[model samples]
Target: MNGRLRELSREESLRRLASVGVGRIVFTHQALPAIRPVHHLVEDDGEVVIRSHDRTALLSALDTVVAYEADSVSGDDRIGWSVIVTGVARRADGADRYRHLADPWADGEPGYVIRIRPELVAGFGLPEDNGHAP
Candidate 1:
């Protein structure tokens, strides 16, 4: 409760993003704000990768600008961090090779790997106001 909200740098934001496994991909489904919860991973080159079924509605997002977000929070202390990545979504190469990175909650098999190049990365954190600089 005593923590302060602070902005996270791009490198720190990407690091925080790589720490989490789940997030939401925001795109247009029917012209309104459409979002889908997804499992994601940060690649060695810093691209954000996400898996989806071949029939997924997320295909509508391909070649378009989209937003992906992930966050971690503590319920009791109300301290947490969130990262949002904005970039163009595109079909990735070697989809079969990255299959093991995600643990999907749905029943269908994932046939696509979507990669988002982090064009604009932004994040914020609510950390306990410790005396030392974060």
Candidate 2:
């Protein structure tokens, strides 16, 4: 397995992130780092949007900094890419307009729509080598 690691450009990273609808949002809870599996949509402007329940911990995290990560990897081939976006989270203004964008896997209504404006975007990938004897 001979392959080189590469840094994905901002565009490529965003593209890869956008290709997937599920990711993890990391934040602080009770003074400790917490992670939540969430479904997200990458807006045309490069912002990320997700829906949360009114009573969830994420509700209190509004206006705070958080990190969102999305990745894909082939376990057998050991090749994949990961992207992370660090940004501030806030409640979106037009909830009605973007309500359809929130598609959670769980049942029940998501009472809040949150958006993350990326302050930093980074990604990396390992391009796999073709099957051949070296």
Candidate 3:
């Protein structure tokens, strides 16, 4: 209970984000906040990519502001790090180089490739304290 929380640098945040494959996308739907679980890929340039079906609401979120989040946690010790990204969501044309980087968890033809170019990237963690940085 005495552990301190530290902020993660943008580089570290993106690195952690890239290491995870599943995250949540938050956007406004019907004037309320909506969250959807999605499988995503983080490009080296810090772009988050995901593929969605044509009928999915997220596909309609192109050119809008959205938030994406990913995290990792330890079950036994309750230590974890979480990264949140806020950015504009846009649909990437099929010819976009990173379009093929989207890896969907489902087994169907991919629909739209959406890329979130982060404007704000923030992360924090409760590192296990053993009288030193974890």
Candidate 4:
């Protein structure tokens, strides 16, 4: 693949994150890194929301720092983009409306709506041999 990696600004990164349909939540479990795929939705205020079950390991990470990552790649060209958000996770109280935003991958309805307020946003794009930068 012939392409360049273009660094995206915080604002741009958030935009990219917002565009993606799903992402991964990264947290520490058993003193080791653990990652779980999650359906995510970027809020208008730039916060990331994800659904979770009570028994999931992510619930243990509430109020703690975690990293969320999402990316998209072009099937033909392999050009892609990615965004990583490091933030504090907290339960969104009364998540009646927010609950449907991030779908749960497990069985049964989601037990909680987890919100991550981005503290650090980083992103990059691979623009498939394009002459112009992303």
Using lDDT as the measure, the top candidate is: 1
Residues 1-134 of candidate 3 have per-residue lDDT tens digits of 24488888898888888887788888987777888777788877999887766346785477889999987755565547888999999988662454454445545555667889989999887765221212
lDDT of 1 by residue, 36-113 (tens): 888889977779999877345788899999999988756565447778999999988876687776646655455678
User: Of models 1 and 3, which has the larger lDDT?
Assistant: 1
What does candidate 2's lDDT look like per residue over 27-107, in tens digits? Answer: 888888988877888989999988766346787678899999988856565547788999999888765665666556545
Q: What are the models' TM-scores?
A: 0.84, 0.82, 0.81, 0.83
Which candidate number maximizes TM-score? 1
Q: How high a TM-score does candidate 2 get?
A: 0.82
- Per-candidate count of clashing residue pairs (backbone under 3 Å): 0, 0, 0, 0
lDDT, candidates in the order shown: 0.79, 0.77, 0.76, 0.78
Clashing pairs in 1: none
- Model 3 spans > 4 angstroms off: 1-3, 76-79, 95-105, 129-134
Better of 2 and 3 by lDDT: 2
Whole-structure CA lDDT of model 4: 0.78
Off by over 4 Å in 4: 1-3, 76-79, 128-134
Query: By descending TM-score, how would the candidates be arranged?
Result: 1, 4, 2, 3
